[model samples]
Target chain A: MFSVMPDSAVRIRDLRKTFGSVEAVAGVDLDIGDGEFFSMLGPSGSGKTTVLRMIAGFERPTSGTIELGGRDVTSLAPFDRDVNTVFQDYALFPHLDVLRNVEYGLKVRGVPRAERRERARAALRSVRLDGLDGRRPAELSGGQRQRVALARALVNEPKVLLLDEPLGALDLKLREEMQVELKSIQRRAGITFVFVTHDQEEALTLSDRVAVLDRGRIEQVGTPAEVYERPATAFVAGFVGTSNRIGAVRVRPEKIHVGIEPDAGSGGESGGPAEDGPGRDGRAEGGAGTGDRHAFGTVAEVVYAGPATRFVIDLESGDRVVALQQNLRTSSMDVTRHRGARVRIGWHAEHEFSVPETGAGTAPAS
Target chain B: MTAVAGRPAPGLRRRAAALLHRRPLLRLSLLLSAPLAWLVVAYLGALGAIFLTAFWTTDTFTGEIVREFTAVNFQTLWDEPVYRTIALRSLGVAVAVTAIDMAIGLPMAFYMAKVARPRHRPMLVSAILAPLWAAYLVKAYAWRVMLAEGGPVDQALEPFGLSGPGYGLTATVLVLSYLWLPYMILPVYAGLERLPGALLDASGDLGARPLRTFRTVVLPLVYPSLVAGSIFTFSLSLGDYITVKIVGGRSQLIGNVVYDNVGAANNLPFAAAVATVPVVVMLGYLAAARRTGALREL
Candidate 1:
């Protein structure tokens, strides 16, 4: 659930965008609080970028109202709006140097030469690019170009900043580094950031609240922990992380414990309600205790990942589940021996949540 | 390698490919030899001959090319105010034609490359090139008819209480502009096409209105192509004589003087000397353009 702010930074009501007969963004409503880093996370064609563009005034919605800082900007052009976008390609002016590129917005607004230059320099310094202002964008590395793009938008001091996968082009290490820098920049500037990315890890790492989208609709909007732990819909449960369907509930892979022996005490055919489970604090810990549910299965496969080992189990109840265990005490040979071994999977019932199955032709109970 | 040689050696084609692969410069020269020879003999050789002729003199009484090295033709060109006027007028016409073509070509190119739908772009390019398929002389004569005393141009301006330019220098510039518009549009369209659409979007997102974005972002990036287009329009207009003869009325340009001297006056040396003026002017233009890094783009 999203908290109600008195004056939200951006509020959209019944937004829809259609290209010909295909609807890119179906009717939706959202409220982004001021200074909050909110992300729209989805797959490539899931309309997350469309929603961000609509918020930035780059794309007009077919029938909806968009309010920015309590002002209606539905029909306004991008230049008239008080929000800037960090384009996916960085889009720095190739002909202009970094300083001039950053000063462009101020110059176009009639800011005097001396003042704009000083501000542009300060903006560049904020991004840790002080002496590189005279260098062309082509001369800088990809990460530097990304910083310049950020400074160019931040120098305008808009109410909100929209980034359309700005770090999508960077390598893995640089992307992680820039993610930290971006979070710091947002904090220093105190501007509401509407980040759109198909990278689920990036969205979870940087955003205060994440909106998981599927097709043209938001599957769930919540904190990263809430979305990952208690997904509202089956699509969210599947997209955010790996989940296994057990009867009427979906459980995460890490919640299920793979053991060689079934415990005598609370390992009956039917289990009781759990008092403390992974759902309480979003962590999978502790040994099986009373009220822990049990399932009989055999290890179908064992995957020895660097940090953890995954066990695929085929249950006697005709359900399949994957259980992950940290390799703190087990070596590669120890975990690899579990392949085809008879095992028992157990987890607390509170770790499971009911998700409405999408496109199953049955009405959702919730 | 010895075993392969004993097994009847590799085929000639394979052996040649192996040799060429071993020596890249040899392969490159082999590839370029034909075109290089043609370019040297047919193009640069003709230019060298013309430059050499420019220093020779024509025998005035016999009307023969004496082939004697002399500055008399150059001296005559300098002393006669008429030759200077013709050269200046030619330069003026070239500048006007280039300017007009650019003013019209840039917007047309932008619309084709950016505004038009992707499916419609090829059709728009074909339409822009449609005029180039027509004969150059036909188009020039067509403009001549339109600029006639009471023709279509004059009739169209009748309601505005204005008359046509009436087949003079303005008419020549107009005809040449029409003839060479495709050259301007093609290169500019290519440059604008290579420009990413996100750059324009980024400019507008940075609080620049469309006009400001065009001035600061679009114009600067597309400047090289504009220069490339002007090279075609400028040089083509400078060396054109037939269009002027068809629609120039009484105006005389450098091309017309060169043509008259070589034809009626039978003064080959004088014509070659006059021809060098445009060549020299073009050389200066190209050097200036190269300094701006426009030729690198071409």
Candidate 2:
């Protein structure tokens, strides 16, 4: 079911890497489009970084092939590959100044001194580190060093740029800032960027397409929205974003609505305030006319986050589900009052996705 | 509270500890006093006496130090062509030994630090250090036997229609390099061990081949440790007299001259004057090495 793109920048066929007895990158197939900002998103030890390293020729596949720009580079040394990696540690040469670190690739390739200097300076400018050429990597701040690493890799103008959690070392504010800068840089460079990160939010925010890896295998590969909305596997559903599994179906927290169940004699238009007691019945399911699946549950916990409030409900169907509500109209007091109150949780049928149960047992907790 | 029945009233040790805690500078001085005194008196005092004696002359008739400060000893050292030759030869041997040690030590250290499996590293380091546990004279004498006529070195070379350079500057340098090789390997190994593997990967990812990466990345970063290792090899080779005596047949080095004047001729002042040469050269070498910021690594 995998379509092979004729102009794909990177293509892998059953790529596998085994470290002794442990399989790191199990058999996998992928095709990354030219100039696409692709991300291999996974938790630590999920083999995303190994895949990226194999793509960069830092690693060799155990029994498969990796094609870069349609050339089989499985046996080539890292230097022979037309890709550069911005290491997780930045890996800027501690002995060289920023400009020289950027100019190293060109220098080794026998680029003339004057031309390489000019190109390196331009690269430094692209990363917005123009005046800090004389400063060594140790002299720069964390974010600045990260930029120098980016500039060093970018200066080569390789066919692909591999970034292995380049922003993982930065603080939250700086990482967010770098995310914007990196996206813009990738756009301007128009080089196929294969970014690897364990941060799901970063993968979703930065990548045009993301491959979610689990246990050395790709669980799902799709656009961020597709992975988030219609996760192919239960693992992807739980990993990419918060998923509330209700039996065989999964629904996002934000899509589930929690409301006070109306009394038996009350009209359907409005539900009166939920009584200060346990849910009316242990099990109830209705609202089929509106094509909405409904369940009766007691609000187990009410969490008031600043922008949104989360309600953890233990449904009567022997399953627990969390529902998120924006605080645009509900204040802290309004959401906090839902604790122990009888409520009806409902979601549109379209929002419910039936994920395969193969990897469900090993999916990370929501 | 009746002084807490059985508790001793501020024992001398407790009181001293409290006093020490209250006065940091006093405590620091007390902590450093013994070693500081030994360094100043025994080490610096001896060095100062040597420098002082280098300026003094001997009473030629009575065979005693005149205690009269004069440049005559230094003048004699300068005027004598043999002394100059020995000093230059000694300097040359130290430089050659250091060079040879580096050439061998670097790759050995790299293999031990980076290429070897992690579990095997400690064993490799101890292997490099195993020779150091033997007595210096024992090792030198062993080399002396090895370099003797029809010795292993000579017999090995005989099949190739060549003979070993028996007992001379070549033998001195060969033996000295072997003796000081551990010194070079240790620092270089520590430096290479401290070098992060990602830096090498990053260099290769930047399109530089392995050799280029070593030249551009590994060598420059490891240079400080190389200098640190050279400090040990250079100074040890420079001040060594026993090794040269064991292998050097007719050649004389600065250390040999210093020894000969003191032992055979009973010329303490002239011996001290000759001793100052290596000390001066070491000081110069240290200044240059410090400029490279290698002393910090040591």
Candidate 3:
């Protein structure tokens, strides 16, 4: 893994933004490393886009300092800033041909006609949209239009590229494909990308670091694994992944152990921890729980996905937990039989993380 | 075919309904065609009578068309540079008014379309066209007083130690431009109102400054509207008689010239001949507008 760059590409410190009665972006502080793939992960109305717009110089922060490549550019206009944006609508000029749209920035900067044309062609080629220079935006498909928007931004060679749900318009398959293409392009271009998306999997899959946003505030910031396994708050854990939280405690991914039933009382008391189990503490002790044995629950539902069977278990505390397993083998009895059947679900103590609760009766401010 | 919400109407009933609806349309078309045909016929007949009269030598005593054929009137018009000079002056005034209308209308239209709020935009746009809604004669009379020596404009200037020029071609041009500015503003505003805002934002993100973005992205998008508005302004100013008649005491354009020739001078043939210049110019502009795709946009 790459360590944080000493000279960050973007440094946002205590950035605050408010729109009339609503505070869209509360004080936010983030450092985006050079050439790093950074994402702001949040639900709708979480101020992720507002923050991105501020970085792109579209929205002036109410107060704070913003630095790009170690130079402060807080008061600059968007054109004066080094950042570029790919809007959700891909606002290509409907009147201009694709080539002109791509060459627009350089032309504005007074680049020579021949040189701008050559650069525009090269940018179009980079997006694999060569020979489409003659088409208008209306004549292109959704994906092609997206590529044109990319080419238009990329042609400027901006130091910071901000994507505001760029793939939000595409269908599922196309969005997935574009995700890969976008990641690869970012790598090749080696520009620091400040991607904004509400999709958790998208953020986790593409980002070197993710900042989980909630109610116009940054809840937690860490790598995908760090955020998923050790979310500082319950909101971060639940929002970033499908988490089964039991009060303030959550069942970790690998801790979700699955097995076929032995005989009745064969594993001892169902509520008690199993013998020889590496418990949550990573050590075995004489107690109701054992090493790798955390809790037991009855199977509430079993969904037979093509590759994996997802089981929802109801624990004694009435908390729900999900257990996923690959379909490596078939049992004599149907997996459906496990549904409504009393069963034991156990995991190591180390697989459970205790985090502060959210909403009403949540943990008091520290 | 019959109209349906989001779907195409099919079958014989739909076709029958569609055909039946066209009956009134056809009737309306015929009704409109009659007036246009009558005007054309009357104008042509008048031109034919005038051509014959121009050829006829005016009675030395009465100065009336004698209904004879002669080249003497054409000779007279060519012999004096005053007629040619007057004709060119009318063309110049019309051209100046049209150019001014276009220059003022564009930014106003752009502001209405892109900057004004949706609720206020209609009110603001209607305000721009308010002059057109006012009584035309009253507006012309008002301008006559305003541009006079002791009007509010002169009064305001008097405080600054300046005075009005009283009456001239310049005053007439100013009044005509004011009256017809709405014709240009409304259409250009309509064109800009139809343009989407997303296109502007996209241009900005693509690194275009505000001015560059307006020039390349916005101006081209509203080109048809601009042309349509300019055509209306040009034709209206060229063919206008009211503003010039009221404001121009002696500095008259072709409109006044045509009027004075037809009624006072009793020179119908020469008046008809003078009117033909504006018609030919308008037709040329209209052909150019159509070729450039402005008509479809309008």
Candidate 4:
């Protein structure tokens, strides 16, 4: 009922904010589609939180216009804006019970008593907190309190919901569970969600689309797979997950193939051209070409993770790359040995992408 | 096997520390007993003795306290119109002072805690507490002079054809409010300071205007501390006799009656009986505050 326009739930035009001398959020433009689960992903101090706060009206941009559903709300107060935020701390009122905390927004909007109760109850139920509505926030556990905060924000039925690291405080298991729960709730509610997180895995698992923020600027904005598989900058490549950098190109550890070199002592034998010989059946599954880009290196370290084993290799070409191999039906890591054994590693040429090379104490340009 | 050949089995200090570490309740009881004993004996015991004396009789002829248990003093206090008036006057003054201090302190404290610059916050706190540094008697006397006829206050209001509220109930109320303003502000400021910025931001984002936020979120969150602060103002005003004596021209409160009974009349039992009124009022006020969950903050 509060929305004035039909599409583009949130539209930010060249938004900027500076805290004295520090440019917290430099000029950035964004368009969030209606009913989209959009995430702003970054490392700490990457201006993702600042952008979310600006959209929620907690921060006034230095210069720009913000519109929700086509109505400009840049100058409007937070209360006047059709947006609600689930805070990082899950800021539930300690004095009020869960029901009252959930009903707070409606009560402030002068909602009728019985209707407010029903809406709050339904919101609580949506968060799986139906029977716990009478509990004070202090009495509830961390995850329960987080659900109360979510319920409190959701009962208002704002046009857009901003979540500022809402799952940052939970433990690993609880965080993973809440991630699935939050996404399901978003789907069921069909409200545009702008979730901010410094954790890349959380963003990738939850967002329909994600904007990669780097040092107060937008590095790239696309679907999670788009940002992950084809990062636009060296910083993004380094931040999202572990990427093996070979000069200007980056390839994931999982994409590289690792196996023993057939002839370890042969001086003229190179792994690439010497392939497609007898007893080379294992090399056919990977590497786009029959004799694709390959390197011969000695195993530096072997790390046996439960589902996968990672082998770090030091190439004779003076570059290093890590290759992760899944543990097939067998239980032992005997296939990849630790240290001093010469091995062959190869990856599809298309898996490699260009990224700038940056040295210590410097950030690569986007 | 790793022990040195010449080393003693264990030093007394190490052994004692190990024992203490193993028995936490014993350690805690040992640590708590001293302060707990002092609190019960020195503070609560004195209060118990005073309340006990409130039921005793005072011999009028010899100016001696008779140990016989009697309700004569309370009977006199209830029957007499003067005592009733004095108690009511004292209660009214205390309530007024508390109200005035809250009116001035809440906004000032809020500004200091939530809005002031980091560098300026300490200076604002210092300014609020600076007046408390002056001696209580000295401040009261200063107010006496300021409210005197042709004094600074009267002179300032001379051109407006108005005069100061010359030393009376009004003067007492004003001076007490001024004296205790920091007491009220400090607690409320500390409460507001500890309030996470995220809560206020969440309130605003939930479609609450600033005033509505204050009325609903900020006010309720800060209420316990506000009540904690009112405890200081109300009790101080209720039991104050020195400030009244310094600035009060003709006004007489419960404290004044107690003081007169104890000093001029040399009636200790009667004074003890009179003092019980303020104690009872304070207890009732505390009970009311506790029901609002303010005692938890305290």
Q: Return the top candidate by lDDT.
A: 2
TM-score, model 1 to reference? 0.92
Q: Which segments of candidate 4 are over 4 A away from where they belong?
A: A1-7, A260-291, A358-366, B1-5, B9-37, B118-120, B155-161
Candidate 2's TM-score: 0.92
Off by over 4 Å in 3: A1-4, A252-316, A320-348, A360-366, B1-84, B194-198, B202-207, B261-273
List DockQ, one per candidate, in order: 0.79, 0.85, 0.48, 0.80
| Model 4 residue A243 distance off true place after TM-score fit, in angstroms | 2.2
Model 3 C-alpha lDDT per residue in residues B79-102, reported as the tens digit of each score: 778878876888788889988988
True contacts kept of 2: 0.93
lDDT per residue, candidate 4, A214-319, as tens digits?
7788877878887889977777777777789765578888887765422231235445542233224335343311236676777788887889887788878788
lDDT of each: 0.86, 0.87, 0.79, 0.85
Ordered from best to worst DockQ, the candidate numbers read 2, 4, 1, 3
- How much is the lDDT of residue B248 in candidate 3? 79
User: How far does residue B45 in candidate 4 sit from its true spot (Å)?
Assistant: 3.3
- For model 4 chain B, give the 10-residue run with minimal summed lDDT: B1-10
Over 4 Å off, model 1: A260-291, A358-366, B1-7
Q: Per-residue CA lDDT of candidate 2, range A1-366, in tens?
A: 123468688988888999999999888788898999999999899899999999988788898888899899989999999999999989989988988999999998999999999999999899998799899888899999999999999999999999999999999999999999999999999999999999999999999999999878888888889888888887788888899889878889988876643233113433543322453531233321122687877789998899978889998898899888666554345557668877777789999987877755253221
Q: What is the lDDT of residue A146 in candidate 4?
A: 92
| Residue range A23-62, candidate 1, lDDT tens digits | 8888767888999999999998888999988887888999
Clashing pairs in 1: none
Q: Which candidate leads the pack in DockQ?
A: 2
Model 2 lDDT per residue over B20-66, tens place: 99999999999999999999999999999999988877787888888
How many clashes would you count in candidate 1?
A: 0
User: What TM-score, computed on C-alpha atoms, does each candidate reach?
Assistant: 0.92, 0.92, 0.79, 0.89
